[model samples]
Target: MTTVAFIGLGAMGYRMAAHLPQHFDSVLVWNRNVDKAKQHAAEFNTQAVTLAEAAQADIIFSCLPTSHQVDEIIHQVDIKSGAIWIDCTSGVPDIARTQATYLKSKNVSFLDAPVSGQTIGAENATLTFMVGGDAEVFDKALPAMQALGKLIKHVGGSGAGFAVKAVNNMLLAVHLCAAAEGFTTLKAHGVNLNEALDCINASSGKSGVTENVLSQRIFNRSFPNTFALLLLAKDTGIALDLVRDAKLSAPVIALSQSLIQAASATSDADSDFSAAVKMYESWSKITLE
Candidate 1:
């Protein structure tokens, strides 16, 4: 019977950890908030343990907020020498690779497995995972990851997952901004919002933003907190760093990053990423809702 340890009990982490008990014989959970960890452990019929105890599991999964959090957890915990560490955080690629190297010195295998799809997707087990690490280690962890996502792909080695996640999120941000601008423009020209979405969905202009997020969430005025604007802005910064390091010219992505940064500065930081529409509305002096 394999034992797995899960760290972080936030939105995505909480849902992801719920599936572990179903797959593994024993599952240990740890969180900074002891009450939350205890609640989840009771709900899932799992064990609530300290970080050090959880670190002794064969596999240790971390779904933290940032690379700095991951570093702090690593330093505080006493993980078994040969335990596998899987990071689900959308962290910097270079930082992920450096952490992987450091963990290797202790005979611990590290993999970056940043996820896509928001909170609803996490609840539905429909998230897509982009993984980066050793082939053998990935194969071993595949079954565990399958419990949390519908699609999982090995992008490459070490930092590849972060690289792919950054690129994908950069494009998502750009598409969302463009969709918001287009939606606002069409409304200004006296077109119905729903009608404009119908035409766009049938045309080449349609994207994930239009087909999934905008059509479903934004139009409904639900604005449920799925992926926060601040997180998206942080991801954009990571993408910008990747682009700069590669000396690549990505004007649209750069622009989108700036727009998201501005959005994050507003109260929308705690709202959904779809709230980028709020930034456009503020600029055009028009309300989509």
Candidate 2:
């Protein structure tokens, strides 16, 4: 029976890890919070083990919050030879490359597979996975990834997944801010938000932010525990760094980054990224509600 170990049992990680036991005979889980790990094990009928024990599996999957956490896990765990390390975290590409090289030295292959859907998507098993690593490594992990996501593509070699993820999220941030600002402007002018959202959805102005997140979650006040604004801001920072490193000019992304940064500073950072609309509301002294 194939064995797999999953680390980080947070919102998305918990659901993603649950599907692993359905495909693999033995699935082990670990979390910084032992209770969460134990809860997941009980819920999924899997084993909750220490990081050292979990690392012995044929494959080790990590969905941490940041590059620092990934570094800590890699340093603290005792992963065995020939185990594949798949990172589901949205981290810096250079850090992903560095970790890939470090893991490869220990005979463990590494793949960066950052996902593009949120909590609802995870629960529905419809996330999009952008993978960066050897084609063979991606092929080997396809079946397991398929259990958690609907779309999986190998974007490029080492660190490319994060690169693509950063770019994708940067654009998402811009689109979301645009949608929120437009909605807020319309609402200020006495336009009904629901009707305006309907029109936007039908028009070329629609985007994933408008159609999926803003209209569905923000206007409805469902929240739905998708990715948080703080995390989104972190990703924006990563994207900004990438552009800065490349000496590329992206004025719009820079503006979006400032908006996200301002939102992250507020109490709403713990809320969903669509909460950026609240920032504009605060600035304009107009309540979205």
Candidate 3:
């Protein structure tokens, strides 16, 4: 029987793990907070195991806040030989590569399979996974991955998934900041925010941020806690690291990162990532709506 274990029960991980029971023979869960693990097991009809028990599973999946937490868990657990570790964290690329090399010495296979599409996508099982690992290993894990995501691409070897995810989020930050500044300019001239967005969405300036995040989250002023601004800030920093490592000059991304980091520092931990636009609004003395 193929026994699978999922570690972490955060906003995204909790929903992502719920899909595993349908595809695997046995599903196990572990969390830093034991009660959350128990709660998930009760709701999903799965077993809640300790960290040690989780390590013994044939396949182990983790979706932590960062690669630092992943490193801590990997060192704490003694994973069985031939086990597969698939990490879904928005993590540092260098750390993912290090973890992969360390796991290989113990006869374990590792994959960095970071995801996009945010919390709603996690709940709906429609996330896009950018995976990095051996081709054969990706093929072997495809069925299990399919249970939790709609689009899964094996981007490259170890660490590449994290690299792709970081760059993707960097672009997202750029779009959001650019949109915020542009909208602030339009608002200065007393243009209807709704009409401006409609035009922007129809124009070359449109992005996922303008169409969805700006329209749904920022304009509404709801600022729901779907994904945290702090996490976005962290992801942007990771992207900056990758950019600098490649010796590329990315002034826009650097500026966006500073804006996101500043916003995250001031906003509550539960604030939605779109709240970064609030900085632009504050600077322009004009609200989005």
lDDT values, one for every candidate: 0.88, 0.87, 0.92
Order by lDDT, highest first: 3, 1, 2
Native-vs-model 1 lDDT? 0.88
Predicted structure 2, TM vs. truth: 0.96
lDDT of 1 by residue, 70-112 (tens): 9888877777988899999998889888988988998889999
Stretches off by above 4 angstroms in model 2 are none
User: How many pairs of residues in model 1 come into backbone collision?
Assistant: 0
Error of 1 at 24 (Å): 0.9
Residue pairs that clash (backbone atoms under 3 angstroms), model 2: none
TM for every model, in the order presented, reads 0.97, 0.96, 0.97
Task: State the lDDT of candidate 2 residue by residue for 1-289, as single tens digits.
Answer: 6789898988999988988877889999999899999999889888999999989999888998998899888988778999898899998899989999999899999999999888767787898999999999999888888988999999999989998998888898999888777877888899988877788889998898778887577877776656888888999999999999999999999999998888889845468777777778778887654
In model 2, the worst 10-residue window by lDDT is 267-276
- Least well predicted 10-residue stretch by lDDT in candidate 1: 267-276
- The residue pairs found clashing in candidate 1 are none
* TM value for model 3: 0.97
Q: Weakest 10 consecutive residues, lDDT, candidate 3?
A: 276-285
lDDT of 3 by residue, 180-246 (tens): 8888888888899899889888999889998899878989998888788999999999999988999
Best by lDDT: 3
